[model samples]
Target: MSSAEAAVPQAQWWHSFYGGLQKMGRSLQLPVAVLPAAGILNRLGQPDVFGKDGLGWNNVAKVFAAAGGALLDSSLGLPMLFCIGVAIGMAKKADGSTALAAVVGFLVYYNVLRAFPEACKAPTVLVGNQCIDYASLKAAAATYQNPGVLGGILIGLMSAWLWVRFHRTKLVDWLGFFNGRRLVPMITALVGMLFACLSVWVWPPIGDGMTSFGQWLSDLGSWGSGIFGVANRALLLVGMHQLLNTFLWFQFGEFTKADGSIVHGDIPRFLAGDPTAGQFTSGFFPIMMFALPAAALAIAHSAKPHRRKEIYGLMTSVALTSFVTGVTEPIEYSFAYVVPALFAVHAVLTGVSMAVTWALGVHAGFTFSAGLIDYVINWGLATKPWLIMPIGLCFAVVYYAMFRFIIIKFNLKTPGREDEDEVEDVTKA
Candidate 1:
């Protein structure tokens, strides 16, 4: 094993500190979790109770409904909170400097795309004859929007990196007030904005290329769903899934509403909330919520008798995290390092999950992972949330059983299945 692999056992102070920040970020989601529930309640009955009249009990209900919606949007909106969440969770040191840097990076990314002329212009393919005048294109280009989540995440990563880079820079005396953490965020934000502005000015075609790519992916339909599933898992390794998600969910497609208005946003709105939106997320519910957890259990059961307890503890935490927050790294990494085939199987299962959901039109959405919390939230608010649970549970059982059987039959080198030498050392140690 490499030094990095061995280092995993060290449990460095930085790891603990970062873990604490992640835990805090996780806790922050609880209150935000309430927003989805409230939105569901209002959607179900509030509108009817608050008549369409300008003023009355119905109007009162509308006010409440609107307030709830706004609160949910502001608090839980991925773009609004992604920077803070990521910065806090991923930063080596939990400080205001990192958080502020993330914010700066996000703003830079947003404004850069927003200012891109090509970004504003609608695709000629979509708007054929309507694209007559260059003036219209210019107007449209000026109105282009950014993939907020993508921008935010990039900003957060950049900010964190910048903080680390400048934390020890000399010139502390001359730039005393702007040194350290405070200086990092300030510098990051300024740099990001400047980069964004320059990119827009120098590379108008880049935005157009991205728009084209999004459209191409959108056109893939069921194949697109499968690709997304595979891609999502792959990106998870590098923590870039959020960026892919932004393109697919928000930038690439247009969702038509019941009243004939078209809107652009993330996949969750279309799959779980919007009445007229397509069921884009129908495919993920099964793999994320059920299958992966089952696999975790299977690996646990197959663990060596001596290591079983430790493996079980790890798997249990991973399973709960997967179910609750949809974060699956703990689980994926558990077997991925030791058993490559199992990871491949896991990836295949993910694709299968998406294909099944897409074929059934069982749409769902999640703020985090495809776990139960998001399932419940989306289901409660979705037009067909009930279908997801039944389907997901069935897959979960299959995953667990198959994984268990495979480990025993193949003698897979999963967690807790180390060689005799290691096992002896572990026992002795």
Candidate 2:
């Protein structure tokens, strides 16, 4: 192929990768939406909350706990949800068959992993009266190592792709019953089995590498957190933060609970009550809950006086969204391209927030975004939760002062400062 042609495919590959990640993020919302409710219920059901001995509604609290706990239950919880959601969301069209295929594929895939040692004839160890495949047992015991959420995602993606590719395939006259969508599950089962067999040999080393990488990151401490915060804000410009989240939120870090069950990723570990769980997440509280909103206020104030009224509503809405829901895109995108330097500064400020929070030993986590709702809902689960407030207030002042200075000094076009005609057009629109 010519050089241009080669470049075309390379560019296409990146586009596909980015597009796929976006789809995966959207698809995951199906399952992720349940997390806030689950987290709240789980917390409220704890002995310290509604379940306290002095509380008359201990039984009700237990019920609430069980209800939420069932959804969060590691075994058949998020993994299965991801499978069904991805199968439905990633398909060319949402189809029940695709979901069914994902579930079937996931089951076969998980069992194959679970049975790998015996299937491969790996040596077993005598454990009391039973001969246990200790290696396999060990892998099984570590919940993170088990083909958990990642495996579900893999199977779901494969099943969805297969359904899209073969769901309409025609069969021989006698085999008409297996034609069309019915063929998807059959193919997925075979493919899932092969995938599982391969993963037995392949995934262990990959898992080890990931584990090693997590350890390296952990060793970096606040520096690592600072780097993550910078990268996260930078990646937001491209809407590719989901790729980082797939690893950091779902697969990074390992924590063992008092019951000896292992949980991986910041969100899971934090919900499971791991003391060290929030290093990856706590910093965003200041950035999302306080800093960005303050920055929004600065942008509003910096607008031309004549246009201030027109832009105030927009700014107020986005600022409230950031503070309450931790969605900062509206505010960030307002000036991200208009004044790239300001965005860069914002990214650095985010990194500083992350580093400071980590260094202070402040542990807080969220089911959704780092917003007021999450901060309050997860307060009981956080270590030194009160500290986040003062930290956020400080960040608010810094963000307001810095953003106001930058916008005015550069005459930046942030929201209300648009050209006269453009502002008129926006108003008309």
Candidate 3:
């Protein structure tokens, strides 16, 4: 094939892959948006808070914790939530049928996995009577590591695909009731069973490998965290950061609570009271709450004297948004395209912040972004909440100095620095 012909197929593949990632990223937000509620409720019920003796709200704390635990607990929590969210989000149309099918499919898949070992023969047998070892089977089943959110995501995507393909299917006269969207759940139930059976053999190795990989990431410590930080920001440039987050925040690690229920991923583990749960997430406090906001100030300061007023309001709004809500998109997009090098510098600084906080043994968790709201709400759960302020202050200085120097030295066209016509266009917008 000619070079152009070869490139056509490659380009198509790239677009297809990119499109899928974008869809998954958007779909993931549905489930993620509920996390803050879970975090707040869980924190409210902890012993150090309203649950304590002097607080005179011990029973109230239990109620709040139970309500929150219903969302974060292993049995019917995040994994199941993801299934419903992803299914509806990814389907051609967000329908109740899709969400219902996702839940049914996940339950069937999960129960089948649990029930399979008992139904099958055990590896060991008694030589005397050649009896099947039911005890071993039960033990084996107990030892099975639930795939957790990863499994939920897999089944959710499958259900969505099924919905897209069969939501309009016709059926024979006698089977009319199961036609179109209604058929989706029935078909998913069978598919879920099949996947469960297949998972008996297919999932063990994959699960083990994933567990080992999680361990490896934990062992990498600051280096793994820094890499994640850099990638998180860089990927945000293309709106793919959610894909990265869904894995790290929802499926990265495994922790078993005192009650024997296991929680997976950094966020869930943290909510479950795992002491080491926040390493992958804590670093963002400095970057989002301080550094990027300071960068916003630098951009506003470097603008032409006459143009500063025009851009100051925009900069200030984004800065406060970053500080209070940890939403940095408004600030990032301003310079992401105008001066790509600054974005690269911003990404690197983010990585440094991650590494520093991680090395300093500072641990914090957030259900959403590293905003002041989450910082305060989750303060009791953090190892060194006060340390974040000091770290954030340092990052503020660095971000301000670096951004100002770069803007001035390179004469970069950030916000108000555009040519007169361009500035007029921006200002008018």
For model 2, the stretches where C-alpha displacement exceeds 4 angstroms are 1-14, 53-59, 117-145, 258-260, 424-429
| Model 1 CA deviation exceeding 4 Å by range | 1-80, 83-94, 101-142, 145-147, 154-193, 202-204, 237-240, 256-265, 275-280, 300-321, 415-417, 424-429
**Each candidate: RMSD to true structure?**
8.0, 3.9, 4.3
**Candidate 1, 318-399: lDDT as tens digits:** 8888877676778888777677777777777776777677666665665445667667645544556677678788888888
TM-score of each: 0.66, 0.88, 0.90
Q: Rank the candidates by TM-score, best first.
A: 3, 2, 1
Model 2, position 5, has a per-residue lDDT of 92
**In candidate 3, which residue ranges exceed 4 Å CA deviation?**
117-141, 423-429
Query: Across residues 1-429, which tens digit of lDDT does each residue of candidate 3 receive?
Result: 899999999999999998888888788888888888898998888888887743869899989888888888654587888888889888886689999899889999988876644232445543332334565552211334367777888899999999999999999999998899899999999998888888777877997787787678678898878888999999988888987777678777778876666777888788778889887899999988999999999999999999899779989999999999888899999999889999999999888888889989988888878999999988878888799999999999999999999999999999988888664553453
Q: How high is the lDDT of residue 44 in model 1?
A: 36
| CA displacement after TM-score superposition, residue 117 of candidate 1 (Å) | 8.5
lDDT of 2 by residue, 1-429 (tens): 899999998999999998887787778777777788888887777767786653658898889877766666554566777788888889987678888899888888777776644322247554332445765774223222365677778888898899999999999999999998898889999998999888877788887787687668778999988988998889888766655665677667767766565566788788878898888899999889989989989988988898788678889999999999887889999989888999999999999999999999999999878999999988888999898889999999999999999888988888888887665553453
Error of 1 at 159 (Å): 4.1
Quick one: RMSD of model 1?
Answer: 8.0
Q: Which pairs in model 3 have colliding backbones?
A: none
* 259: Cα error in model 1, Å: 11
